[model samples]
Target: MSKEQGRTWDTSLFKRVFSFTKPYGGLLAIILTIITVLAILGPLRIALIDHMVHHFIEAKDLAGLRTFALIIVGILLGETFLNFATTYLSQKLGQSIVKDLRNQLFSHITKLRLKFFDKNPIGMLVTRAVSDMETVAQIFSQGFLSIIGDILVLVFALTMMFVINWQLAFIVLIPIPLLIIATNIFKKAIKKSFQDVRKEVSALNTFVQERITGMALVKVFGRSKREAKTFSEINNRHKKANIRSIWAYSIFFPVVEILSGLSLGLLILYTLSRVDDPGVNFGELAGQLTAFIMFINMIYRPIRMLADKFNTLQMGLVGAERVFKILDTDELIPNTGKVIKHDFKGGLSFKNVWFAYNNEDYVLKNLNFEVEAGETVAFVGATGAGKTSIINLLGRFYEFQKGSIEIDGEDIRDIELNLLRDNISVVLQDVFLYSGSIYDNVTLGNPEISKEQVVEAAKLVGAHEFIDRLPDGYDFNVKERGGLLSVGQRQLIAFIRAYVYQPKILILDEATSSIDSESEMLIQNAIDKLTKGRTSIVIAHRLSTIKNANKIIVLEKGEIIEMGSHAELLQQEDGAYRKLYETQFDGHEV
Candidate 1:
């Protein structure tokens, strides 16, 4: 949920993560088989060492020594082959799981309601979808199978040591409990540090993404120094988190080396004292001693690295917790009924609507309105008068409480969401263009809209005049967010995009607010052609823009204060519309 929450790995979490590997059952089985064989070879390798020393070297058996050396080489080669296979399969498994998760996250996010995006930062979501999922991938690559193989090797090595010489084996294991205590302490500390690392990474990502998106503002206001200072603080936190993890590693590994040496010392001391005993053949015991030393390395190496691997496992679990939390969030706009098709007559009504973004803090209160088919209606109001909220409600971008919205005398809730939205199109003031060619942006990559239709729609919006001047004409690339295009040019593209949809209802939300007067005049005729014989709702701050509307509704604090034709509203004695026209339009002809 948050950085403050527990990040410890639990059995249930492991089970959940392991479930993702089920699709690769055949590959996972092969990996497990390789680990089992490698584990079984652990004791056999030590036994071979004993044979080569006592029977071949000490007894001077030349042919036997040659044979034993060959067997050792063969074993080494076979182990190498199995290790390669294991590494290859582990990587494949990790990548496959990450691919599935990325697709699912992208699909889920695309379908989520706009309200969800309002609450979560884009940088945080990107971190979860990209970086956090990579941590999950590590659970397969370095965390799960590798740990299992190390443990199996340790288990087999210990079994062989006891079988060879129980007394010496018991002496060699004296430091085990101490090693365990140290490892557990290291694990707890590193888990917290790793969690801190991930938290700092996410915070740093959010800060950088926001600052970069607003670089123009920073430069305009001369706030570069202040912004850089803030970024430095976040980057420093990230560095400290990494250093804390390094401190944990610095303390843990050397302690493991010390305990390993202690074990070796005790084994050597016991073997030397038993050297002269008649029951103990000195040569054979020395070989067993050599094998026992190798066993110590084989055993403790895994034990020591297990703390680090367990830290990876813990970080992965925390990432999963964040990822699944978003996947489990119930923020989707429910699609209940399915209506395949509707011939909407462009009628719309909002009956006694009361709404709020936050609980009970209404932005739209008791709003009642209706529009007949094929009428051009304009909503005029000051900022924060809930003008855009009405458009958002009609498009079903949000749900309202204690009211019903209808289309063509049918409750909009009864209509399928896609079908309802398909019949209405909105052109916002801030037009957003995707990174693509002009034709792609106009048709929005819809296969059903032909190239000829896209050109026709652009001609209607008068966008083709400027578009034809570009080097590639219709194929000219509008790079990221259409940065290469002017605001007026981008708005013209929006008009074409909306026109290509051919909707029954068209909404222009301050659509020409940012455009130059010449561009606005060019688009005015296109707007006249696009809205003819269709229900059009226009929201504008400029009084001159909506003067020709069939009806104008004046709003104040979410209530309809005046409704009439433009001339009728202006004729009222000291009316709100007349006052707004005087204050906003001044000398501009209307």
Candidate 2:
């Protein structure tokens, strides 16, 4: 068993996992049958050796020996067939389970609210989805099945031994209890070592991921040596964990092998002595001893295999517990309703909303504003002025407390999540690109988009010029968050993505800050066309970006301090907008 963590695997977890196997039930049954046949054949093959040596060898008849040889050959062939069947079916089932787990974990993770991610490390979450799931799958395939097989076969072997010679059986059984105790002790030690190793594995994965993701930052700061040292420390930790596990295994295997070997030797010696007590023929006694030794050896494999499986299952359970911890986290923002499909007529209103991240530290206080359909509104403020928080609430990324935000006359929360989100889109401050062709990256999952539309949108934001210059143009792969593209180019493509969606409510949260001045001019034109007849909210510090807005609202600590046209706000000699204009925009044009 894994040490008590905050979460542990409920036995019911297995039932939940097996629920995926309903479709593969027929294959599972066949696999189990093969395992049973293999188990039976293993002991029977040992028993056959006794019959052959005792009866046929003494007759000095070549025909009889040939008959036994044929039986042995047939058993070998049958075992081989059964082994092949088990391996293939087990692989199929394991892969199926892993695929289901990966998809389920991914879907569930995406459904979870942002707060869950805020508290949990992404490295740990990723470990659960990929590495941990693999571990559980191995347990389900080999650990789970072989444990049952080992127990059943061990029982059968003992029953046969007792029937053959009860006294000799007692000698072999003496070491069985000690072996069980040793296995348990080693398992505990191994579990601790594995838990440490598993944690280190997650740490290494996280470090590597973050390092690669932020390679530019590291290179800019010339922190390569420091980063390499940090990685070496985690790598050493992982190595130490593995070494400890190897030690436990080293100790455990030798003990099991010695005990099983001792049992075999003792049985052979005792059986030879038994010949003097009865009319047991010397050949028959030798045959029984040989059979007993072979059976002991055969049985040791299952015993050792079971112990190994148990160790692996424990590690997998630890992983599952970690995964379930993420799955079980309270969805900080719950969307409760069928997906609504009502299109917004581009109206937006906030009713005296009071909001906070947690229980305290209110970011937004009693505040209100409304924008008419097809209106463009701009929000300008310094960092931590609650500009982005409002955007997040508008998109339902987080829920606001103490107020109602309405879209098209209905409360946003009352609208079905799908319906609400479908009517709205946000081009966030951070531009993220996936590893795919530029066209694929631009269109995202919107399959209805045509190549012409993708190119049109790209052209709208000046992304097409450089894209066409690339070796494969729109077909060029982005390669991991557009690492191959300039940041300004990536931002332009992201803008095009937001425009292509043609949302009723569009929120640009500092979406164009990374773009060059020339591209910004192109994006401004694209924004004009895109925001036509839609509710558009722009958050920006650059005066150049918001000059065309119908109203510019200046926020101070989540409260609207000034709301009016750009000209009116600029005219306010003592307004917060003028102060921001002086400090941030300075000589830049409005």
Candidate 3:
């Protein structure tokens, strides 16, 4: 893929992330309050140590010293308990925020129109749902919480140090501006590096998934060596990006360490010069020294944390952008229509419909067709002759640009999408079986159905016989995408799925194309029973399968050039249907 065609996570990411917190405003507020308390305790500990050195040590009072030691121990224990509590609360809040994000993202993506999926691969979408959602979860789960604590601590430490001794604070802070500038510069470079790393990662993910899916083809073609080389090239790019990121951090962390160390050395030199002139007390010197060292240690950590988070944040932001990109896709066909809640009484008509994938060119143009209640109409055409497109339109997968589709007497545009789809069942050319028991896959179409109903549906589709042949029968576990089953068996299961729905309208888009002769015959009989009292639109390649269809429409290019019963079209001289029949049946008995 070209760089121009692919995209990284977008830049305007913070606003999107912060928006997720809106729904969980209450939990976030409590988390913030705990964070603020944690921050204030930063300077409080330093100040306590300073006071112990100056007052207790100078007074040479063992009793006072003992009391101070006890106070220090108590503060340590309190902070320990507070740390655990705050951590628990932050985790709970983070998980809540991520759950809300995942829910919104899931709902939004599922509602996106088909054209979105047409262009985006299933692998990329899987990345968004799994990897991207996990990334966002981590950002909220740990990164944001840590950042909050760091920011607050930095703020309190800076303020208290300045108040304690103005001159020393000014001298110590000289390195602060330089450190900030260095970190900001490092941040941009590292963010870009990590962004490159993430892009390469997604590319690798896409590449591996695509190859695994095409493994059979690759093995047959003997192209494993070439494919491995290609994979290695991509993997190496990812490696380089990771190495560069590590190098950037290596330079950045040690630089922070040195700058912070230098600040301490300068502060000590300045304090020593003052002590001789003012005849400073030993205990007072020790007190100031302890406070200064603690403040310097505090400064370096938050700086490093602030810098490091950008690495995680940028990667997560890019992931989030991809997820949101899918969510933000426009609906190609909006449902401004009324909900089709009541069962459809079948009558479906397409009035002079002109449809196109890109909307500019025609796949089906000015086409007019209608199926009466309980009619079984077959669309038989050569590949890419707009046969499947007809089924797509019937299922409301795509809307016509130049004409209207009506169901029963009402325009389909006026029907709520779910309500319209509720009474329609589509069996596509591709039979996707999930990794689960036979019963799980069959009943997936309508889980509320009874066990007996599932078995009945399976028997009707001729799936039960082979299902029973399996080790666990209906409970047989299918591997990934039902790879464990033969293609024909999978198709039979898909048939059972469609039949179980008992939809008002049935769409069979080459549904029987993958199965064997025996299974196909069984599927044909099942279809005959299933479509007994329903409207069925079938697009089939096997001319024999549609021989019994009540009406047959043959398309050439984007228009229907011929139409009649199987017998009527057969009798026409060199009719389009006759040519199709001759091609398929001439080679093999139809």
Query: How good is model 3 by TM-score?
Result: 0.93
Give the per-residue lDDT digits (tens) of candidate 1, residues 47-106: 898879877888889999999989988888888888888888888888898888778888
lDDT (10s digit) by residue, model 2, range 446-527: 7899999988888776678888999899999989888898767777787788778878999988867877787677677767
Q: What lDDT would each prediction earn against the true structure?
A: 0.87, 0.81, 0.81
lDDT by residue (tens digit), candidate 3, 403-457: 8888987888788878888788888778888889888887884658777988998
The lDDT, on a scale of 0 to 1, for candidate 3 is: 0.81
Residue ranges of candidate 1 with Cα displaced over 4 Å: 1-7, 587-590
Whose lDDT is higher: candidate 1's or candidate 3's? 1
The pairs that clash in candidate 1 are: none
Q: Per-candidate TM vs. native?
A: 0.95, 0.95, 0.93
Give candidate 2's TM-score: 0.95
Judge candidate 3 at residue 403 and give its lDDT.
87
